[model samples]
Target: MAPEYLLWAAVLYVGAAVGSFLNVVIHRVPLGESVVKPRSRCPACRTTIAWYDNIPVLSWLALRGKCRGCGTGISGRYPFIEFITALIALVLFARLGLSIAFGVQFAFSCALIVVAYIDLDHQIIPDKISLPGIVLGLLAAIPGGMPAMTDAVLGVLLGGGLLLTVAWVYERSTGREGMGGGDVKLLAMIGAFLGWQGVLLTLLLGSLLGSAIGLVLMASQGADRKLAIPFGPFLSLGALVTLFWGHAIVRWYISYAGLAEI
Candidate 1:
């Protein structure tokens, strides 16, 4: 067997490659564009990116975050996402190795990254990612894992149902749609992978983070409390945190609240 560190390096490389692809997914999925066809090109000049220039973060850094063809400044986000993906792979590989758990969580993390960024830009969570994500999450459970199939199934139901209910309630009370259908689907997709407990945690954490940021914006820039803000990134952050340290976090919370015996 390969040394553990070597295996980790390989996983990180694979992660970087997937991150590169995810960049494409983030850009194209919301626009109803195909990710597979049409080679990566410079947006400024329509020049096809060569293999050497497409080496994920490395290529971006080497090119000084500029389009090699047009000399236009490229987004630093390209390299940042690749680095984050590599870091994620390193973490998951160190924790779960190359087993089914690692593969399943990797896919889950990739979806989160894509959906988070796309929603940040467009405020929409495309069904292309979330719906299939729901099915894949359930299927991953069928093979035996951390999240039991029952847990995954319940997570999907609870995640989607809870949000739908909230959306319904808010609309009735406020006479306006407070949340989009995309957020509901996004949470459902998260539940499919992380389970019901994860869904609960994501809701709590996402709400807290979203509200905190919203308040900060309002206080600093005169933003209205009702100003629209994206919630998917916060949910994504919560799911990722739960995936790595949820049990410990839950236990800590219970103990802190003097409910450990319960």
Candidate 2:
């Protein structure tokens, strides 16, 4: 009932609204459709969604995940995305408060969410997001920003270079393309925001997470060894982890490896 609680609630509400918009981005961007012109609608029936029916998680719950006009089942992913976006916003607010840092990180996180979902659905990370993101990340790294500008520049180079090198080597060694250019750009964008150190950690974390999940899918589902899984989501997850705990993680690793003095 306190003012802080009220503030948090407002933050959550706004976050969910943003998420709703993000859902539009995720759905429409890949198809080259304008996200703003067309209002939200029930894809099943082509009926325009009413404002009340479009309320973040609540509307879906009210409608029981079905179209009000047609009773067609709506994907739960809509609400899930909304909820996750809200949670991400809350996490950022809690960590960074209402500061420039919060705004920067929130925008970065939203981009990741959009990239991740788009890649999952289409196996492609659109340049529309990552290319501009690289520029924005560098801008965010200006004085009093997340990472120092020098670090951000290095991050761009190293992030792009590291992935590119790996992708090139992988293709040459296998005589097949093993990675996409999108992954390289995505990392570069991450570097712009988090710096070269963050990029390194993000790659380590993303690769490990991707490999582990891949192995699980192969084992549990008897999936193909050559199963083509999209890597953007994993990278996004890694970036999020780094954004929140990169410093602590690095310190822990240094102590664990007895490399604190190295």
Candidate 3:
């Protein structure tokens, strides 16, 4: 086999293994349970899963998405998360090669995946993830060779401060909480990694996507009231888009909008 192909395969396997661990985090973090010490188990029967039966996507396929102990249905989410993680690893590898950039961005992407899924299930963005994430994101600048540290700090301030001010103004005007504190922290974390440009793009795109989806859901249900929608997933999606294509999108806009000179 080609060496390049072998390297790609290795990345996929590692990514999948990490994905499996992320599954544990997703289940345990929201519940305040320890992720370590407890081996993988069948949720239905609480039977400890053997190593052979816990091999990422393969295990799910082998068991046909059923718990071997109780024959209860297992969530398809496991394999899906694994697959997505593997794909992300491969794509990041392709885009950045086997470099520090790949490693840091890969980790950031994984955290975003965990954050997105958890927020979807619990309507929360965990402080455990986002809080440390902001700090680590700033640190990533030194080793990851990303935006300048000053830009990163500005990004954090802009991201967090912008949303906070909005939420405050919104509450004062309507006497209702318009946004969650979790989202502010989440944006701050994103800004730490991607810098101010990324912060702006994520906010704009995330808002558009969230608004469209929220409207559609409410329309489908014929509800005039605001739905209890978690905005984290849309924000995650926006961050991912910015991570991959922000520069390209910005360049395109600059050229198309006749701002190439300035």
> Which pairs, if any, clash in model 3?
none
* Cα lDDT over the full model 1: 0.90
In model 1, how large is the Cα lDDT of residue 189? Answer: 89
Clashes counted in candidate 2 amount to: 0
* Tens-digit lDDT string for candidate 1 (143-248): 5665898899899999999999999999999999888898899899898899999999989988988888889989998958678888888899888888888999
- What CA root-mean-square deviation does each model show from the true structure? 1.5, 1.7, 1.8
For residues 103-123, what per-residue lDDT tens digits would candidate 3 score against the true structure?
Answer: 889888988999999999999
Q: Which has the greatest TM-score?
A: 2
Per-residue lDDT tens digits for candidate 2, residues 1-262, read 5689999999999999999999999999999999998798888899999999999999999999999999999999999989999999999999889888899899999999999999999999999999999999999888878799999999999999999999989988999998899999999999999999999999999999999999999999887889999999999999999998999999998999999777
The alpha-carbon deviation from the true structure for residue 163 of candidate 3, after best TM-score superposition, in angstroms, is 0.6
Q: What lDDT does candidate 1 reach at residue 221?
A: 81
Give all candidates' CA lDDT scores: 0.90, 0.95, 0.91
Rate residue 159 of model 1 by lDDT. Answer: 98
Cα deviation of 193, candidate 1, in Å: 1.1
